[model samples]
Target chain A: MSEPIKTDVVIVGAGPIGLFAVFELGLLDMKCHLIDILDKIGGQCAELYPEKPIYDIPGIPFTSAQGLVDALLQQIKPFNPLYHLNEMVETVEKIGDPLFRVTTDQGKVFEAKIVVIAAGGGSFQPKRPPIPGIEAYEGKSVHYAVRKMESFRDKRVLVVGGGDSALDWTLNLAPIASHLTLLHRRSEFRAAPDSVNKMMALVGDGKIDLVVGQVTALSGGDGQISKAMVKTNDGSAFEIACDALLPFFGLTMKLGPVANWGFELKNNELIPVDSAAFETSIPGIFAIGDINWYPGKLKLILSGFHEAALMAQKAYRYVYPEKRLVFQYTTSSTSLQKKLGVAPERPAAPARAAT
Target chain B: MVQITFIDSRGTARTVEGEAGSTVMETAIKNGVPEIEAECGGACACSTCHVYIEEAWREKVGEPSPMEEDMLDFAYNVQPNSRLSCQIKVREDLDGLIVRTPDRQA
Candidate 1:
């Protein structure tokens, strides 16, 4: 609400689908700004499976998940869409007919004539370890993210998970914490070799305790944790007395705040959009990609691309109601070619899902 | 086709037929076994398709690759016999394979 950055279209996600939307909107002379929860773009492609090979992306025979995202970034370069990374969209409210006020958890706000919900699978959030009664201790003695290291001074800390985040924090907090313990389900670590060596040295020096186990339960009162019940692979249970517990269980996609935004949801998961314009019940708001649900809808990247193209056609009307809309293919239209920064005489190469 | 039985955490067992080349995760998804999320669609990027291979079929299923072992670190309640169903290929020798799904996927 603090003098929102005005834009023609504010896309709620910067995933592959959202990135593609920028291109379609740009072809129609509409500037767009995109936002994503992850620190980096590409959403699941970058976070979950960057190296995995992806097939069935139209003409492209094969490309890695990251490869497709790179291609998309290159294709949308002409549009030069601004991306607000490491931010989560928290609220969306309608201010005027076909106009919306969108705000992010990072306090950035945007006022746009068109709001596109291209958020696929909602947003990636920290995965909570399914330990019994862990909720009561959260934000008191248990923390997912460390905002400041000074808070852990002179406290018994238990760090869980074998990934980089777990190893990184364990090494950083060991010196400050009264007694630190690194608990993992297995001996082999997913962290870098150098960090593992440093961790082992700490154990050798008796600076930290490395327990090969999983947290089964938490015992605490008034949101202050006192002890944690851990179970080893051999089914033996032991108690780790700790004031603070940090469990790094990676991330999972959830329907997050978008579920609260005024709209219709199918099965409380996907936004329901009509197939023609891929617009939800709300006017001037459109949804594309896997986040959208329609009758006989296939959750494929290609399907999302098709949805983006059709949604742009309807979105142009909202951004420019007085101007007559003309449909032009990038393959043949000189104006579309100019927008693509290509030679008008030679036809602009059609945008493949991934080059 | 090979037959696979998926036993949920509640002990409800569902048996279904799977093609020889498809993955156990795919078979569960095709049959609507209700446990395999397969969030990454058999890319082995997520642990949602995690299942504990029964003791009887442990040897035939084999050990997880080092890459898979790294990914298992993200799964919940991982046991000695745990394996990502997406990595388990359905085959003639693995007919009547029984696997148990954990209470939740991480």
Candidate 2:
């Protein structure tokens, strides 16, 4: 038999929510193993639009996705959570009370006392456009985004899509690229008004070319993107020479291996979970984030935050029933200033009154 | 039909036949390839079907959509050549393509 590996918790997916779980679990002085499919952590916040501003998350007035990820990482830095990147979790089975057999595509197995299925919409896959010859130039000159801006320095680039991702990349690439072109099937952009306004300014100054048309064909030379054939709505066609092409179209989410785990699903898609604990029909297993479904659950980052905390608490109670949680306040001062150096001059007011 | 080869993390290579327009993920799963777990049924919502394209064939497989890129951030074992097999539609040009499965699947 293989040597048994054990931990307090195993968190799948390194996205913002997953990292948040690490933060919470750390606060409880628990050890955890964090895994992600990507080479790095941060999940959607790090991968999708790191620069895009997120306004809804509490506490911060406005923060970029990457910024939020950085802060959360800092919060959990002291816990020393173990991380396994570029690894996909294929199966999660409950072997006994609070014990799980987690297997991966690589055949490595991990046994943990508790499992948190924070896989988050499973593996994320992209949807490609049906443009003819688009696949002809994959690595040489065509890309999904200018992932690293330095690579596109002094090169002519073509960007497709009117959405936030496309527009954002275009604006970012405008200054570095030798020449930049933006193509969209429709004249109007789907990006935020601020981004659209920036693109308009760049177009007005001739820093970038905005072509209103759809890409019909892609031709490559020297194993890289060379020219693109675009057809306008008014029966006009043109070809633009380019060194690289980036398509910022969005991605779709797949259920991954969990789909076959035999959980009851609603609408033949989302996994049905308990309204309170977010547990699926399978005991000791829980689903959170966009992949879960219930009567009145709102699919948002904040809601996922709430779900993860509650799931952790319930899982903790199951694993260590003898442990009692205690909250200690050194003093009655509500604000930071009074708590630091001086005891409250008045007898501690009722805790409820302070609120 | 296009014949594509997939190398599991263990370096075992298996070839599968894919009909034109079917996704690489579909071809692998239909043939009982163990590496790809297309969790979202090819909707681009999940990154479970992630595969790394051979460097030589990277240019042949175009860039992923923004949605796919975003999803890829959530995938396991992502590489510069990483692409979601479900998002890649099989065609005659991709007949000799090779992809490698990550060491783990989410």
Candidate 3:
């Protein structure tokens, strides 16, 4: 057994909610150990489409996922959370009163007074289309998304899907790709109206080709996509020569290691939790963010914020039962008031005339 | 609509109704089935949505993409039938298909 490191709290995920827990815990002068499967923090906010605009989150009227992550990082910078990235918590078990043991995949063990499961959507896995002989061209020409846009420059690219990502990438690659073809299973796109209009304009000018069909096969040798075979909605098949095939299909959320913890799930879907406290059936273990389920539950970033804040208060109470949380108010005298641009003398209190 | 059956590792059978055009992950998620965690929202980034198809459904579900296969290498309890549920789409002919979620997600 590896030597166990101890801490006040062990947060299971490093996403926005987990980071908020860390920030709150730090405010209370508590130590926290944050763990995540990804190499970076910000959870889904950082991992998902960073460039895409997110209008749902509160405070910022409109911010990209990456922008939100950057702002969150700045807020937690002072706390200096102990981050353990590129690691996944394999198992969590209650050992004693208000104490738990967390073990990682690498055989590392950690003992903590409390465990906060801020693992949003757990570990995200992208969905891939079922295409024959596509496996042989795994690393060669097939791709899920182009993290590096420069890679496909001057290349003949075929972008698939009717979603926003598909349209976004298609538009982005239009100028770079020597020949660009956009294929969708449906005639109408699910992308934003503006993007669809722009794509349509490009198609009208003969800048790109739009094909409504499903990719059936990939033809190439020595590990690269040389040509793509697509079947139209109407029993028609056509082969398009291409250097790269990019699929921008959307994603789905899954429950990871927590599935074995034996928490009751409604309809075997989301993990059920206490509606008031957001605690799972297991004491000292809680689920937050999109992974949680309850009566009147709203799965949103704003809702996760409320859940995280309330859970932190309850967690604090669990860790320190005797200590009463206190909010200190700083009182300023005349001298301090002057520095703050406040008048030295207080205005006369409103006359207390008998009503 | 496509009818699919998911048998959890604990041997609980759950039959879910899925649209022919949606991915298996979406079908399972919509029906409140506790399997596949399409963490990346079906973007083929995370492996929390790992599942093993029944021998009969393996050919029907087909093979996962290279990126998905690489991610499965990082999943817990990987098996020959192991596949990311988000990668498999539901079709009319895929009714009665069976899949088993792993004991753990990540």
Candidate 4:
């Protein structure tokens, strides 16, 4: 247990919408602390589709998903939104009207006047394989993702799954591993055609072993896996010796602890929100982005942007009920411009324009 | 001002006034009509603002772009008259624009 970090707002999920919400809330003089499950910012943009191009953004003709996140990070830099990455929110308890305390899996607690759930499709987590006794080697010999390639150097590695992550890591770790094995449920793969071809090429070159079977058991001592039992599709089981296991079973979005917060849920899954303010059943808690459901709710980035704007309006009232709010545009409002660190347009410089 | 009629999931009709050049989705949100989710504002990246344009006004609304049509795949119970309201710009000629929302937008 530790002292909870205090802020004006606590935003869950550091996705594109959540990042934009920081700018809107900051413009209103509210400080924000953002919590995300991934180790980096930009949620799915960075984690899933950083290189993918996104169309339909209003201003720019086109931008990569990560490029959009980078621009947003630069836009909100002046706001100094604090980020708590690599942590998932575990509990959110409303202490008072418009006041709540949020705790993360890492034991960090945050207190804020408003809680904004910008979690896009909820938190993306690795789907664990149904191997018996696999939990013992979770952080030891078994890993869902590779953090350091050096860790696998000279070690016998076993890669699982049929997706891009599995094939990519298998290709990357093959050269360094003393012995590498790629195990999947079938010979066919769900990964990109190129990666699958490359993996087959590796297998053909005898650089690695490809086994079509399911890992059924783990055998190890001292929390380290030494061997895995694989059941082939032909109903034959065999033992494969390995020291490191990388399972890329893909990611599943779970509502996680947010589901237990007791807000009225729509579809027994998504949070029901009032279109007026994007507020949830709770007075202080608000749901935005893909986590919310309304009569015509569309899970798009721009829609989340609108929800964030309206949510901020009501949040401002909750944070400062006695203060009068004056809506102002960044273009004309000197105060807002100052907060954004923009100098007023001055006499044009001929040399600057020529360059 | 342009007048737009929005039918909710329950078949309730509400007529609201929208400023010229503003999106139909924007107008519905501004007027506190819950039928149009318009989650993406006017980005046209989502189909949450899907609406059925009246047969008489379908030609005026025009056909959806390929991208809008692609996004409509994610909408629930889409019809031939379905259009993403975010792409429909309010104008003087659309003074009597009539559209109805679907049962839900996934």
Candidate 5:
């Protein structure tokens, strides 16, 4: 219920394209506030494939997913873009022409002149496991993702799935849990070998118990889990007593509230944008990155970069209708360099008198 | 150059020649073929460029990678011959390629 934070642009999604959009909008003297569902800045790059090598970036031969994110973070530091992580944008209302009010799931509101959706693949929602009556325990005992380790302290913790989140939370919460159990449908995990090794070591030391089974049911009272009925691959069923169940079943993308933002949509998901300014059906509202659709739209980061450049040009007119735009390349534009906090070259240091 | 024919949902077809070493999605975009939307530019990230390769040219275009297949899951009207046009590279042997786009991209 706090006062809505005001900015020139409100960018949804903190992916590499979103980050780059900050630089583009910043060069136009438009301050930005970026909102993302993930707790971190990088979207799939940092979350899904941080170390994965990406070979398609222009100008750079190759870079790791996270490396590109890190470079972009450094590049946008001069802009000082405000970040609102771990929050999903829930509502977008056009208050005026070229003015919008955006609200997040966390109750934070942002008022801006332009709303840019750089949301790659929309909002990432955790894939919930299929278990009868599990919905009642959600946000109480059965959690999809661990938000705080302190919440699991001195509690019976059962971590599920074979991904990195399962192994990570199991390792992190084992020391503090009254009893820790790691459960998965398969014996082999999709997590990193080192994390798997460390988890096995914990099992060896009796700090944790590894169960190869899937949760079929949850028995609890007053919206809290008391025990989990697990079914093993060998057709064996057993009950594991636990107070907290952490299921890391990976994430699925949802258009979320963005779908109802009053823009024309294709397939009831992505926003349809024009090729010129990447603007949606709504004026001053631009859609870039993977969340947008056009006749020749490409979901590549480089394509998003190009879209961001064009979006900023059109956005500048909306933010400053009277001011004429002068396009300039950063390689020779001193004002652009100044905006990026780069000092001018000192005339080749006067050659030091030929010393 | 490689000649590729794109068939729209309404059975309209457009034949265009694309330079070698570029992707089918890129070539289609450049030639203003409405079938392939190459949204993500030629990145295997979006399924907007989903297409059904002609049965005759299936062996030539080859199969999609597991990554590309995952993206195709989001595409509309995916068939057994479904492949992301972005993942299909233009080559000399890929001449006379024919593919049909879905009614709408998912």
Candidate 6:
């Protein structure tokens, strides 16, 4: 119950749309604090396909996914928006007319006049490998993230996946675990060569066992796993006894806490918002980006930008009830340019040598 | 038009007309076939569109690319015949293609 950080707007999900919302809100003199479950901003663009080329953005004919995120970060630099990363918003309770108290899972709180949910595809959570009855051993024996290395001390550990997460954990825990096994579907690994070579060196030293197989089933009792039934490429099935299983299948976006926020959802997934202001059923709480659904909702970055501009217009009324709002363009209005920190306009790098 | 048959985990078979050169994932999504969640929208970045090619058509469907193979690491119940439906394009030569969705996608 720390003192809540008060702000004019609290934007959930620091994705492209949320980042743009900061610029829009900043232009209107509304300060924002963005919260995201990811440790870094850019959401899926950075995590899923940072190298993928995006061609749909207006004006910019070509830009990579990470390119857009970096540009957005640069565009909102003047706003100085506070970011609370590695935190998931737990609950949002309306305390006043157009005012809400937001609480994160990490116990950080915020009191704001507006709440924007630009959570594109929701939070990226570790994919739960669809093993039958694995849920029973989730917290007890099965885990996705390694919060404490000492927890696996002296316990037999099974690390799954061919990525860095698997190999890194395998190498880190091999010393402490009574026995360690690395199970992957194939012999080839997607992890870095250095880490893979180190893991192989460990296997060569008899410190860790490498198995080319996939876990199909788990047998256990009372929320503790006894053994996991594995199937190899040749269709042979075997069992591996272990006290811990760490399956790092990478991340998948899920409509996590957004579903519990009391907003009316269209398909148990997306929040139903008005096409005009992009506000949800609740006042002062708006949803943008792919997380929102309207009559003709198009889940695109350009569409999310349009939604942010309009949502900010409505958000201004909540943050500044008695003030008059006159929309001005950044190109023509000196006041807007002043807010952008280029009031007098800096000389343009000598016109690029007139090439 | 090429024809594709998709069988869900429960063994429910769905036959649909797929346009040649279009992706198998696009055909399933357009025809409203369930169990094919192309979360990345055919970018091959995600493994949600994972499917197992029928043994008879395994050779015709061809093996996965190196990139698809890497993404398959995130999929469930992956076998030698498994493929991401997004990477499989419809063709006239493969007039009768059959694929089965896994019990769950990653």
Q: Say which candidate scores most in TM-score.
A: 6
Question: Tens digit of lDDT per residue, candidate 5, span B7-76?
Answer: 9989999999988888888888888988676645565655678889999999878887767755554454
Q: Would you list the clashing residue pairs of candidate 6? A: none
1 versus 4: better lDDT goes to: 1
Model 6 CA deviation exceeding 4 Å by range:
A345-355
Residues A232-349, candidate 4, lDDT per residue (tens digit)? Answer: 8678999999999998765556677878999867776799999999998889788889889989998778899999989988899999999998999998998999899995877876
Q: Which candidate is the best by lDDT?
A: 6
Docking band of candidate 2: incorrect
- Tell me the DockQ of each model, to 2 decimals: 0.79, 0.02, 0.05, 0.03, 0.05, 0.81
Tell me the TM-score of chain B in each candidate. 0.98, 0.96, 0.94, 0.94, 0.94, 0.98
Residue by residue across A1-355, what tens digits does model 3's lDDT show? Answer: 8999898899888887887777666666567899987768877777666766778887689988878778877876766778898778889989988899999887889999888888877765445666767778765688875768888999999998876788899999999999999987656675788999999999999999999777888888988888988887567898999999987655434567877767777766577888677888887877787778888888788888788777777777778888997643225444323333453667899889898
Judge candidate 4 at residue A268 and give its lDDT. Answer: 68
Return the lDDT, model 2, position B2.
94
For candidate 5 chain B, the 10 contiguous residues with the lowest summed lDDT are B69-78
- Between which residue pairs do clashes occur in model 4? A302-B40, A303-B39, A303-B40
lDDT of 4 at A249: 64
| Candidate 2 ranges with C-alpha deviation above 4 Å | A1-4, A126-251, A327-355, B1-106
TM for every model, in the order presented, reads: 0.94, 0.49, 0.50, 0.61, 0.69, 0.95
Q: Per-residue lDDT for B50-100 in model 3, tens only?
A: 889999888878887765665564455455678888888888889888998
Residue-wise lDDT of candidate 6 within A192-270, one digit each (tens)?
A: 9999999999999988999999999999899889899999988899999999999999999988888899987888999
Tell me the TM-score of candidate 6's A chain. Answer: 0.95
Give the worst 10-residue stretch by lDDT in candidate 2 chain B. B70-79
Model 1 lDDT vs. the true structure?
0.93
Quote the positional error of residue A320 for candidate 3 in Å: 1.7
Better of 4 and 6 by lDDT: 6
